[model samples]
Target: MSSSDIFIGEIIGTAVLILLGGGVVAAVVLKRSKAQNAGWLAITFGWGFAVLTAVYMTGSLSGAHLNPAVTLGIAIKDGEWGNVPVYFAGQLLGAMIGAALVWVAYYGQFHAHLTDREIVGDPADKAIEGPHDTKNTAGPVLGVFSTGPEIRNVWQNLATEILGTLVLVLAVLTQGLNDSGKGLGVVGGLMVAFVVVSVGLSLGGPTGYAINPARDLGPRIVHALLPLPNKGGSDWGYAWIPVVGPLIGGALAAGIYNIAFA
Candidate 1:
């Protein structure tokens, strides 16, 4: 694909991916939504379908490497770094755009969810502590857009993401993926979607399975910048785990693929 095709395709595909994926979370978590508290199965399937749809839409153009980890893995596998920056830029931009759209789509629910007096707290005044084993936070709702560790154990959380992403990138590699190994074909897309759902169900409880760097970073960035009412801290302290863990996992997967699977 041409640079323009890759950039535009990734931007559009990734935006659609987050819009649907995050939309499901908002439906399940925000107040009074029909799907509220619908539980993890719903989220896993929602994200699976989101990946399938986005890949189908952009598989030909930019290969729909919507996740930065996937982009990195493919680059490492192929030893072509020239296109990496364009792909990353598009994915990040798309994620932010998708998150903003979700805010618009769930505007009423966001307001209702935040306005509830029980969870309302001044973001400027709170101590802004991390997510301990305490149910003490009320607002940010960034979990809908990104990932967060349930237990807040740094090493454990990072390892979990690395393992989960290893499975993901390895699955993509072992399948003889296309688009410079950045995307999957129709069958491959559906299979990878199932891999994502599998990761969420099996490994998600600890840290919410942020196997994709852009999937977390872009939305977290949006959470910080957007004007969500009384939204709590953005939890920047735990942000690096998602981005770094996935990158490490991708590189490791590439190395393994080259060493054994190739």
Candidate 2:
């Protein structure tokens, strides 16, 4: 495929990824919304569908590495070292743009559903309510790109994200190796869906399994820009966990695959 073709595919694929992945979070977490508190099932299915759409759209050209972590992992495994930076930049840029679009699409809801006071919150209460209550609205408003533990400490939260991403990437590699040329046309999609479902069902409650960096950072920039009620966008203390966790997990998965199959 031409470079331009791959670039366009990456853009479109990443946009779809953010839309569906972030969109689901908005549906489930937004106030007085239809899907609020719809639980892990909805999130998992939403993400699974997002992956399916992205892969179908860009897999032929760009391999649909919507997640930078995934791109990095693939480069490590296949020695596509020169293309790593280009892919990473494309993924990040696409992610940010996609996240901005999500904020725009949900603009009306954000204003109508929440008040400015809620976004900023009271300084005194910030310490207490910031982490807990923030999850309810912050994730949907900013971007569904990161993960954090509901009540656990930072270490546990980070661990949860890492482990979740590990499972996700491992599943992807396993399916790619075992199902290739076996008529598993859509099995990759199904595998992704099942892996996400497993994580959400079992491990989501702790950290909202943000196994992807672009998913979080891109939307976060949007959240900071978009005007919404009571939006604090405090960067959630240490925002790096989502990015680092996923990378760690992706690399670990690649290494494990190499050891086992190579």
Candidate 3:
């Protein structure tokens, strides 16, 4: 595909991916929403469907490699680095756009959730911090925009993220073999979507399975930048784990694919 096509396709595809993926989290987490507390099953299925929709919509244009790890894995597999930057740019920008849209869509819900003294806790108990306070850990609404560890061990969190992303990129790389090497076509999208849901269900407990760098970083940045009251810290201290771990996982998946599957 041409650079322009790849860029535009990735932008639109990743935007839609994050819109639905992040939207699901907002629906479950935000107060006053009908889907509030719909639980993890809803989140897993919602993300799977998001992947299915985005892939089918943009597969023709850019193969819909909406995740940076997926793009890196494909680049390594195919030895095509020319378009990697374009894909990364588009995915990050698209992710931010989609996250912003989520806030827009859930404007009232966000206001209600954040302003709730019960949810944010008593202001008298703790001083109110800015939306992007770096010292504090994740805020109540941060989970909607990004992933965080339930238990914060550096090695454990890194390993979990790497493992989750390895499964994802490895599955993506080997998908062509299942369909006679045509890339992720119609059936492949559905298959990959299930893989995502499976990853979330099985391996997501530790660090929320941030298998995609752009998926985490882009929205975290948005969470920091957006004007949400009582929106607590962006948890910048743990930010690098999601980004670095996924890239390492993608590269590792490529190496394994080269050795075993190639």
Candidate 4:
């Protein structure tokens, strides 16, 4: 694909990816939404379908590598670096746009959720000022945009993210295999969607399975920037884990694929 096609395709594909994926979380978590309290199963399946839709929509234009981790893995596997920056830029921009769209779509729900005293506590009571309290760690609705761990253990969180992303990128790397060990198709996009759902169900407990750097970071940045009352910190301390771990996982998956599958 040409550079313009790749850039435009990634922007559109990733925008759709985050819009649906983050929109589901908002639907389940935000007040006044009919799907509120729909639970984790709903979230996992929503994300899977989000991936399916985005990939199918843009696969022809740019191969639909919507996630930066997937882009990194593919680049490493193919030894191509020239377009990596374009992919990264498009994904991040698209993610931010998607997140903003989610906020717009759920504007009333966000206001209701954040301002509800029962949900976010008294606005006048002041935020908890502790070294490791939940209030200071993350905003009330940050999960709609990014991932966070139930238990804050750095090593465990990092390892979980790395492992989840390793499985994801590795599966993506090998999904094109045919019966004759040659180039062919095997419902690759649908299989990748299943892999995402599998990763979310199996490994999401530890760190919410932020296997895609762009998916997490771009929206997290938006969360920080948006003007929402009582929206707490963006959890900058934990931010690097999602970004770094996925990149490391992508690189490691490339290495493993080169050794075992390539």
- List model 4 lDDT by residue over 1-262, tens digit each: 7889989988998999999999999999888899999998999999999988998888877778888888888878878889999999999999999999999999999998888767775442232222444454223388899888877788998999999999988988888423332111237778889999999999997788889999999999999899988788787888999999999998999899999988
The per-residue C-alpha lDDT of model 1 at residue 163 equals 96
Q: In model 1, where is the ten-residue run with the lowest total lDDT?
A: 124-133
What does candidate 2's lDDT look like per residue over 1-262, in tens digits? 4556656767788888888787787778666668888976888888878877877777766767677777666666666666666566777778777776766766666665556455434443333224445434333344344444456577887788889888887777767422222111355766766676787777777767778887777666666666655555546565788888889999998898778955
Winner by lDDT:
1
How does candidate 3 fare on TM-score?
0.92
- Candidate 4 error regions (>4 Å): 122-140, 176-186
User: In model 4, which range of ten residues has the least summed lDDT?
Assistant: 177-186
The predicted structure with the larger lDDT, 1 or 3, is: 1
Worst 10 residues of 2 by lDDT: 176-185
Question: lDDT tens digits, residues 96-192, model 3?
Answer: 9988999999999999988876766543322213333434322448888888887778899899999999998898888732343424678778889
Which number leads on TM-score? Answer: 1
Between the candidate structures 1 and 2, which one is better when assessed by TM-score? 1
lDDT string, candidate 1, 47-147, tens digits: 98999999999988988788888888888888899999999999999999999899999999998988887656534223333624133254437787788
Q: Rate the local accuracy (lDDT) of all candidates.
A: 0.85, 0.68, 0.84, 0.84
Q: Which model, 2 or 3, shows the larger TM-score?
A: 3
Backbone atom clashes (below 3 Å) for every candidate: 1, 8, 0, 0
- In model 1, what is the error at residue 147, expressed in angstroms? 1.1
> How many backbone overlaps does candidate 1 show?
1
